[model samples]
Target: MKMVFRWYGEGNDTVTLQQIKQIPGVEGIVWALHDVPAGEEWPMDKILDYKSKADAHGFHLEVVESVNIHEDIKLGLPSRDKYIENYKKTIEKVAKVGAKVICYNFMPVFDWIRTDLFHRLEDGSTALFYEKAKVDDMDPMELVRKISDNPDFTMPGWEPERLKHLSSLFEAYKNVTEEDLWSNLQYFLEQVIPVAEANDIKLAIHPDDPPWPIFGLPRIMTSQENLRRLLKLVDSPSNGITLCSGSLGANPRNDIVGMVREFADRIPFAHIRNVRVYENGDFIETSHRAADGTVDICGIVQAYHESGFQGYARPDHGRHIWDEQCRAGYGLYDRALGIMYLWGIWDSLERNKQEVGA
Candidate 1:
């Protein structure tokens, strides 16, 4: 697995490329244009600009975390055609910059849902937390306000420009059902997979954040069967998955190791992280260590290795440790440590193989 790190561009992020470079085996950054609205073409000059920065740092620009899907596409509106064309243009632009994969999600309104951004852990470190009961109890706007109230930095997915229309956005999806979402996603993949293939860029859809419906919105990209259906939509190698452990693992039945082995060839990108799932349906992001969380970090890595994966992977959301004043769940300290933990698993597996062969 070729490891990458998520970098939210130059000034937008607290973690620096210099710090990222210090992490062993991290080869590139998973990035995006935060200011660019969905459905608009990504500017060519801007794409090359990030390319220049990556070149300067000697880091590969192999994967982008998201080129968000326009809501019209998910809603199956007529305007979605224009948005698909724009997405094709964006894909072409990212390809020019040497990107091999573009990771995007199809969740209706919010990209990822969480009740608390800095939920304190027993060890005093804090991580992203999702409270099941809270999601059902709070108003959607109230939840949005709570998450966006952070004064430190503007949270991703909760962009003010987008959330400004939260009511309308949620209203747009009221009539849409799970089958409708699947059909819309298929329509989208049908249009874009050819473009992605032509550009040698794999279009990887991230699994639904909690692998379930939220706020009465239909979420189809939530399970293995749905994933299988997604691939069959395009029936091309360019059509694939991001294979995020934390996102799909929230359900406790995802069998991440099995998923990795099954979808190995289709997955060109991975979001490797762990989460502690409670019997109450609440969940919290945890360290990459196996013992610290429910997801089998070691087994997942071994499955990727055994599958002969030559794809890009990254350490996903990490705890805020050492009192790091950074983005919620994206502090450099824990993530860097998580990188070492993942690398330890990967490297140890390779060493074990060599020793056995010897």
Candidate 2:
């Protein structure tokens, strides 16, 4: 596994590239032009600027966390074709900058949702938390306000521009269903996958944040069967999955190891993190240690090692550690710690294989 770190770029992020490069096994940064709105064509000069910065710091800019999908594409609006054309152009621009995998999602409106950004844990560290009952009872606008209350930092999915049209977005999805979402996603893949293949960039779709429908929004990328269906839609190596453990692990039944074994060849990127699920259906993001959470991170690593995974991987959704104030779920201290934990697992697997060979 080639470990990478997610850097939101200079000025936008508290963590610096210098700090990222100091992590023992991290060789690259999973990044994107966060300032650019979804569906707009990315300028070549801007892409190069990011590459130059990473190169200057001795880090590769080969994997992007996302190129946000336009809501028009997900909603299957009449204007989707134009946005898709722009998306294709952006894909070409990304390829030009040597990004091997472009991680994107097809979720409508909000990309990921959490009821609390800093729910205090038993250990005094804060983490991104989901309260099941509260989500069911809370008003949509109230939830949005709670998540975006931090004016100083920008949340990944809750873009201010998008949330500004909260009521309109909810109304627009009134008639859309799960099947509609699947068809729309297929339409997107059909248009974008060929271009991705031609550019030698794999399109890895990140699973829904909680792996479930939220606020009555249809979510399809939530389970193994759904992932299989998605892969078969394009039926190309370029069409792949990001294989996010924390997202899929929210549902205890998801066999992450089985997914690794089954989709090993098609997975080009991974977001490895842990979350402790409560009996009441709540969950809190935790450290990457296997024993600390419900996810079988150790078995997941073994599967990746046995399958000889050569793609990029990163530690996703870290806790707020050492009172380091930064983006919710994206503080540098815990994420750096998570990287070492993942590296420790990978090293043990490699050493065991060598011992067996000897």
Candidate 3:
């Protein structure tokens, strides 16, 4: 596995490229043009600017966390064709800058939902938290206000401008269903996968953040079976999965290690993070250590090692440790420590393999 770090870009992020460079084993930056709205073609000049920055730091711009799908595309509206064409253009532009994988999600309304941005842990640090009861009981507008009101850093999926039309967005999806979502996603992949293949960029769809529907939204990329169906939708190598552990792990039955072994070849990107799930259906992000959370991060890494995964992976999210004031889960301290933990497991696996061979 090639370790990468997520950088939100120069001024937009608190963590600097210099700090990211200090993290051992991190070879690249998983990035996107945050300023570019979904459904619009990314400016090649802006793409090259990011490329220049990463190149200056000797980091490969191999993976992009998201090129967010517009609601039109997910809702299967006619305007989706224009957005789809723009997406194709963006794909071609990023490929020019040496991107190998583009990670995007198909979740409608909200990309990922969390009730709390800083749910305090036992250790006194804060991490992103999801409270199922609150999500179900609270008004969608209230949830939007809580998340999108943050002025310090922009949250992915909860863009203030987009959520500004939360009511209409929800209205647009009123008639949409799970089957409709699957059909739209298939339509998207069919049109885009050929372009991805041509550009040598794999399109990896991130599973729904909680691997379930929220606010009555139809979430289809939530389970192993759906993921399998996703790959078969287009039947091409360019059609792939991001295989996020924390997102799918919320359900406790995702069998992440099994997924690694099964979709090894199809997954070009991995979001390796841990989350502590409770009996009440709440979950808090935890350190990458398996003991800290419910996810079998060790076994997941082991499966990747055994499968000889040559894809880009990142320590998906981290707790805000040492009072670091940064993006909610994109803090530097815990994630760097998480990277060490991952390397410890990966290195031990490598040693055990060498010993067995000897």
Candidate 4:
């Protein structure tokens, strides 16, 4: 596996590329133009600028976390065609800059949701938490307010400009069902996959944050069967998956090892992280260590090793450790440590295989 680190650009992030390059096995950064709005074409100059920055820091710009899908495209509105064309152009731009994979999502209004940004864990470290009962009964607006109240760093999914119309976005999705979402996603894939193939950039779609519907939004990429269906929709090698462990692991039914074995060839990127699930249906993000959480991170890494996975992977959603005040889940200290943990697993596996062969 090719280890990559998620670096929010120059001033937007506290973790510098210099720090990222110091990580033992990390060779690249998973990035995107955060200031750019959805549906707008990404400028080639801006793409090249990031590429130059990564090159200057001796890292490759090989993966992008997200090129957010426009709500119009997800809603199948008439204006979707325009946005899609712009998306196609953006794909070409990213590919021109040597980015091999473009990770995006098709979730409606909110990309991901969490009840608490800093729920304190038993060990005194804080992490992103999801409270099941609270979410089921809580008002959607109240949840939005809680998530967006943090004015220090911008949350990935909860863009201020977009959430300003939360009521309208909710009303617009009143008639959109699961089937409607699937059809719209298929429509998007049909338009962009060909372009992605031509540009030699794989389009890896991230699964829903919790791998389930939230606030009545229809989430289809939540299970293995759904992923199979999504792959078949485009039926092209360029149309792929991001294979996020934390997202799919939220649903206990998802067999992540089976998914790695089944979709190994199609997966171009991965977000490997662990989460502790409670008996009451609550969950909290944890360190990448296997014993720290419910997810069998060791097994997942073993599957990737056995499969000879050569794709880009990163440690996702780290805990806020050492009193390092940074973005809720994108803190540097824990994630840098997480990368080392993953590298240790990969290194031991490789050494064991060599011993067996010898």
Residue-level lDDT tens digits of model 3 in 11-41? 9999999999999999999999898777889
The TM-score values for the models, in the order shown, are 0.98, 0.99, 0.99, 0.98
The C-alpha lDDT values of all candidates are: 0.90, 0.91, 0.92, 0.91
Which stretch of 10 consecutive residues in model 2 shows the poorest summed lDDT? Answer: 148-157
- In the range 1-358, model 1's lDDT, one tens digit per residue, is 8989999888888999999999988889988987798888999888888888989989988899789898899999999999999999999989888889999999888889999988999999999999999998889999888887885665667778788899898888888989999899989998999999899999999999999999898888888888988888889999999999999999998889988988999999988999999999999999999999999989999999889889998888999999988888888989998889988988898999999999
Error of 3 at 158 (Å): 1.1
Give the poorly placed runs of model 4, Cα more than 4 Å off. none
Selected candidate, larger lDDT, 1 vs 4: 4
lDDT of 4: 0.91
CA RMSD per model (angstroms): 1.0, 0.8, 0.8, 0.9
Q: Report the error of model 4 at residue 349, Å.
A: 0.8
- Angstrom error of the Cα, residue 223, model 2: value is 0.4
Candidate 1 to truth, TM: 0.98
| lDDT value, candidate 1, whole model | 0.90
Candidate 3, which segments miss by more than 4 Å at Cα? none
Candidate 1, pairs of clashing residues: none
Q: Of the candidates shown, which would achieve the greatest lDDT relative to the real structure?
A: 3
